[model samples]
Target: MITINNEPTAYTPIFLGTTQHSLRLSLEILIMVGMKLNDEIIETYNVSVSAIELGQLPDIGSEIAIDEITGSELSGFKAKLKQSDAKIQNTASTELEKLVDLKNVGRYQLLKGQKNMTQELNVPTLTNDNLILMRQMLGVTQKELSVTMGINEKTIRRIENKEQGISERFVNKLLAVYPELAQIIEVQFDWVSLTFPDLTSKQVIDDVLRLQDNLFLERPTSQNFYTREMAFAGEKNIYIQDFAPFKNPETQAIEQKFGTTLYLTGKGTRLFEKALLEQSMNWRNFFEKARQYRGHLTRLDIAINDKWGLLNMNDLVKAVQEKRFWSKSKSYAVHGN
Candidate 1:
């Protein structure tokens, strides 16, 4: 049933197919029709929602012949037209409400999905000091980090300055913005590969050993083909190759293309954990040196083994399927059950 001037109007064939599934699509059609009818109806009349709500419909006022609207027939025609107009208004209002509700639902779902994605990714006893350190290591100012992390600059400042204690919500938001931080959160590196186009192997080795007064690692040992290799106790090792392998034309061409002149690689996590644990290796200084030497970072890997089972891949997939998340990937695929 539909209301018309406080009276109920039943569904009829005349109103069938008048409503559209998509209110926005219907609005587009109405706009197009209004544009086309501009010449015919422009400046002739104006109607608005307020007018409709106020029941301030325009007067018919001698527009129709007196004979055409006479007695009971005229009254019936007037009632029917009023009923149709009221039904249209009600339908439009309902559809508009639906559109607003849909928008709110989408917003809620997206936030919920994001929460689910980061709820378990705790930063393991995060503190104001570490937060400051992370920001400094990333080489971003507080304002720049706030913009990138989607957090307020004032909040970041408060947290870093010890005015506010670190909260789980803040850490979750931080990790959501920078999941890579999990790997390097504690200033640890799992694997690092650097190529120096200008510096010799000896120069690179000397710089590494001199970083912390050679207190961590033993002296370098000669390796087959490779110039030198240094190792801390355990499985951590740094391998250096003074020259690129140009065994064949193909290898030489590959080296030329990639520019692997003097390759240096530090592999395994124990190297940092044992050897450089107490060392103050300024990453900014290292980056500046690399830039000075025109070195290339061929490979760098960061990963966190979720031994505590913090990550949920299933929820991530669900978020993607529900279109409740944003991504840079052109496309995503779901394999297996």
Candidate 2:
């Protein structure tokens, strides 16, 4: 029995050594024992208490103490709990690493496949704005257009809004349904025109050649010179006076062909003279050379010479300067000069 504040209570011995006793009293007795032990140490005493005896005492302390064996067991249990917690944390970390590796591998494979597909198939994509514009231009509602194109209306709407990507088959279907609309939605090229004045005969010829090439013309010919029959149509008794006197038969034939008959009008004469002066060539000298070449020249020879000679040079220069020579409405075969 132990006295707690002068009341008797049962007690239990925690450790019993030879000639020694260690007691762990109940909380109520522990408090009273603490007060008594505070003043003096006591001799060894045997004590015992049953569980039923402990129930009769009033509850006083928050904590209960087990025997020494149980206390030692609790410490070992806490150590095992820490080890288990560590093992669980390590397992979670390993699983996380594996998951990350798998995700990265999947992403790499997907990217590789996409690259190969892009190279294998030459597919073109259209933007949302272009898709919408094309649909509007074709005057088709989403549902009707989708039905005609053999695609889902929701897919069409998604493509138009850029919410979803379009497939090559869908693009082809749209093109087939609205051929003109495809052209309207395509990227366009801009054309620019340039103007110049006072270009030389050579320059005009070069420009015309360039234009012909651009327009995809096969064969281009100048309209300056004419053939024998073409030059002297109504003339009669065309006889050459002296072959040596004229440098070219073509020139001679042309002179004989015209022979002062093809009189130039006042306006035509002024235009021709202006053209020659602008080209910085002597018109008189040109005619003299033509007369010299005309002696025994063939029609083709004369035509070629005249073109390369002064007439074309002067005319081309004038046409560029005045804008009057090459009008579409003006005919090349005038009766006069």
Candidate 3:
């Protein structure tokens, strides 16, 4: 009989076959045990006396000496039974430890598998999410951003949603405001292309008048006849001459009479090209410097020239004094240039 939860439970039968393949009538012994809680059928068998001499019975089982009436003999039998019970208990404990270890290993493997699955199923990219984050970081409303960028708010919404393709012009406008948006969007710098709108007739006239005012402010006697002619030519969609009346009086008189001159050789044309090239190069240098510095500054302090020959060198010294600039300088010295 076996005890479970302080109650007697039945032991089930275990069959062991012999080479003879026939039941041993002398070995048959009926054994009775208690039923388990689940009402499972139990059977038991008694060990044969002959099988004990052949070492078929386990050494831990109880041994009974027939007709033994001595107290010493009875005490020896009880000690052997206790030793057998201890051996069974130790075996059971060792098996329980192995099962616990296997369970822990299985749980760890399951967790690791779940982690790998999550990494594989991660989202593709964050282009749209980044666009929204950038817009929010700038602290500008969609309508305000549209006004500053000269684009419709609907277009901005579409870009944030990734539902519509972004045009180069719009991209450029965004970059101008938030330069780091390029890195966030994971777009190559050279892929950007911008097309500026042509000036309207009224805008041309206004620009010409503004230039006239500037020249008049600088020199009251100067009529800025060259600027007026260029404005008129621009309005008429005709090419203007490159005559510099201020520098050359003869060319100026001839231009005043002809009302037009070749556009290429004009001082304004040369100045315009030089300014444009300088501005473009400055922007390129600024981006390079920003990259070298790892985006440290909020604004670039590089010098840039305008079409009217206006030079801006407001913060060049401060930029050079920065630690990042010194680091770059050291690297350049160590290298060839």
Task: Please provide the root mean square deviation of candidate 2 (C-alpha atoms, Å).
Answer: 51.9
Model 1 lDDT tens row, 88-207: 333344434333222121110111123222234233466687788777767899999899878789999998889998776887787788765543311123456677656545556555
How well is each residue in 200-220 modelled by candidate 2, as lDDT tens digits?
222222331111111111122
The candidate, 2 or 3, that scores higher on TM-score is 2
Residues 1-337, candidate 3, lDDT per residue (tens digit)?
4432244434322211111111122232211111222332232222222222222222111222211111222332111112332233212223222222221211101111122112242222335665565567778888888988888899888878789776646656776765434322110111111111233222222332122211111111123233433322122111232223334465544322222221222222222222223233332453353344232322212111121111233444445445436443353222221
Score residue 42 of candidate 1 by CA lDDT. 17
| Top-TM-score candidate index | 1
Please identify model 2 stretches exceeding 4 Å from their true place. Answer: 1-125, 181-337
Off by over 4 Å in 1: 1-188, 208-236, 244-269, 273-279, 305-308, 313-337
lDDT value for candidate 2? 0.30
Q: Arrange candidates, best TM-score first.
A: 1, 2, 3
Model 2: weakest 10-residue lDDT segment is: 15-24
Estimate the TM-score for candidate 1. Answer: 0.28
lDDT of candidate 3 at residue 235, scale 0 to 100: 20
